[model samples]
Target: MLTLSIFAVLLLMLLIDIPIAVAIGLTAVVFFVAQGQSSFLAMLPQRMYSGTTGFTLLAIPFFILAGNLMNCGGTTQRLFRFARALVGHVPGGVGQVSVVSSMIFSGMSGSAVADAAGLGQIQHRAMVDAGYKPTISAAIVAGASTIGPVIPPSIPFVLYGAITSVSVSRLFLAGAIPGAVMGLAMMLAIWLMAKPRNLPKDPRANLHEIWDSFTAAFLPLMAPVIIIGGITTGFFTPTEASVIASLYALALGFLYRDLTWKEIPAILFTSLKQTCGLMFIIATANFFGWFTIFERIPDALITQLAAFGTTATGFIWIVIAIVLVLGCFIDGNAIFLITLPIFMKLCPLYGVDMVNFGVVMTLLIMIGNLTPPVGMCLFAVESFAKVGIWSLAYECFPYLIAILAVTILCAFVPEIALWLPNYVMGAAG
Candidate 1:
């Protein structure tokens, strides 16, 4: 009866188009009120407060601010120049630039939506002018943008880590390999598709031009290295690393004379607005999570699943299948926050390492950003590039298959995800 009621309320809220965070919070409140549980009501505020007050969560705002700062401070243009020199000679040169720029920007920004919005403007115009199809250009930007969370300083990773109590530092390390693999996969797909079409390539830059772009992008490129290096070396926590990243971005912008005093207010305002929206979602998720716990939903799920098998590998594949289906509907972050506690409870039964699980989960969530209905990156790129959503969706099939193949590889072989972190950062303490 309780489960049915909860679902009903959830569906009702969804039909009305309430924000996900609000729907979750309201559903939880309705559940508690109906049960007439006084204790649960008392616990709600504390749970909500604790959920939003984590020291680890401080990284969210810092990273958001840093990304905004980098975008505004000329990092995007420098990286674009570097990408063009490196890959602009290929068929669909500017198309390739979109993919490479997304890869580079992933290290700094971590949000696919931001990547699409920021890089889409530059890449779309160039690709259109070069005689590429608008749908192809839009599809490329949307597909490439999914790479953001796979790279270090990933916002999704931080949120997942906080919810599941995994080490954000180790998750950052784990993402390095998979992120690179995804980028390569996308590049290969583009090369194959674009070659037969005889798409135009940008003239190869000479040595002086290549060297100039490289030198200009050098500092911005090092932003991820500094943050990841500091965390892995025990010099600072993830929160502290975020602060360092912001400071570093600020320094680069000031030194490069890219960020003027006039731009400071706009930057701050943008960061603050984005941060508030994200943090509100986190806070509301906290309230919803409290209700989930009080209802014993996770424990019920564990007991039921235990009836099948207890092995880590089996449980992982099961969860992956579930997330993929869910990905077709829900936004990635909402899925993460709502389902994390359930997964965390199940992890111990399978003896799965939370750090490795974190990486795998991040990959799966990113896949969602590329798929249909509610894919954030897909919609953003399609709208901006003025391509029909259906056409872009059809074109994305091959890329989807390639990404699924890589995801399956990561799932079966945990070493691909964990090796770099262990080798480069040593074991997490």
Candidate 2:
């Protein structure tokens, strides 16, 4: 009865369009108070505090700052030049550039929204000028941006690690293969879709031009290497790597004269706002997660699913179905925060490696970023490209299928997600 009531109230809140964090916090409060467990209220503050106060949580702000610094310091443009030089001569030239840029940018900026906004401007304009339809341009940017969280330094991975007690480094390593596969999938989809149209391609850059662009982008390109290398080598924790990333960005901005003093305040303010929003959601999720455990929801789920033959593959399919469906309506981050605790309890029973599971979960939720109604990246790309949302959704079908294919592959062949992590960690050991 309590579970029903809690879920009913959550559904009501969702229907009324309440903020997810507020809805979660309020629902937990109402459920606990109704149970007459007044003492449970005391757990709320602790949960919220512990959630935000983690050493891993420190990485969130630094990463946001680093992304901001990179954008403001002109790194994004330089990366764009390098990407265009490589792929702009291909069929659907700008579309290919968007896919490649998103892959590279993913290693630096973990946010899909950031990737869409940053790259959408350049890619969308180029596509339109080259005579591609606005909807197709928007679709490509939206689909490509989803690659952000599948790559290393992914914010979703950090959140998953913090919530699930999994190793973030291992999760980062696990993402490498899947991320590469997804990028290739997007490229293939674009090739097929654009080939019939004979989309205009820029002439390939000469060797000297390619070298010039590479040299110009080298510093920004190395940002990911420095962060990932430091973490893998035990030179620093992920949190420390974030700090170093921020410092590196700051140096590039100020010392290199890329970002001006006048821009510093705006950049910091924007990053802080994003940080606060993310932190609030994390804190509130902690409160709701506590209530969930107190209710034994995960245990209830396991017991109930046991009646239906709880084989490992069956359980994974069930989870994938649920996440993919729910992902259609909710933001990926919200799904991550809300469902992670539930999965953490259930995964061990299925012999699932937590790190590999985290990678799959992150990739699945990221798919939501391209779908309808509430896909943040979809809205971002549409707004940037001035494309109609419905038309963009129509154009996104092929790339969506590509993403679904990659999701299923990663789901069924866990080694695809686990190989790099296992190899790297084995060498280290």
Query: TM-scores of the models, in the given order?
Result: 0.93, 0.96
Clashing pairs in 2: none
Error of 1 at 191 (Å): 1.5
All models: lDDT?
0.82, 0.84
Q: What is the lDDT of residue 47 in candidate 1?
A: 72
For TM-score, the strongest prediction is: 2
- What are the candidates' C-alpha RMSDs? 2.2, 1.7
Off by over 4 Å in 2: 1-5, 427-429
| Per-residue lDDT of candidate 1, residues 270-383 (tens digit) | 888988888777877888876787799888878767776566777888889978876766678877887787788888778777787887887888778878776788887877
RMSD of 1: 2.2
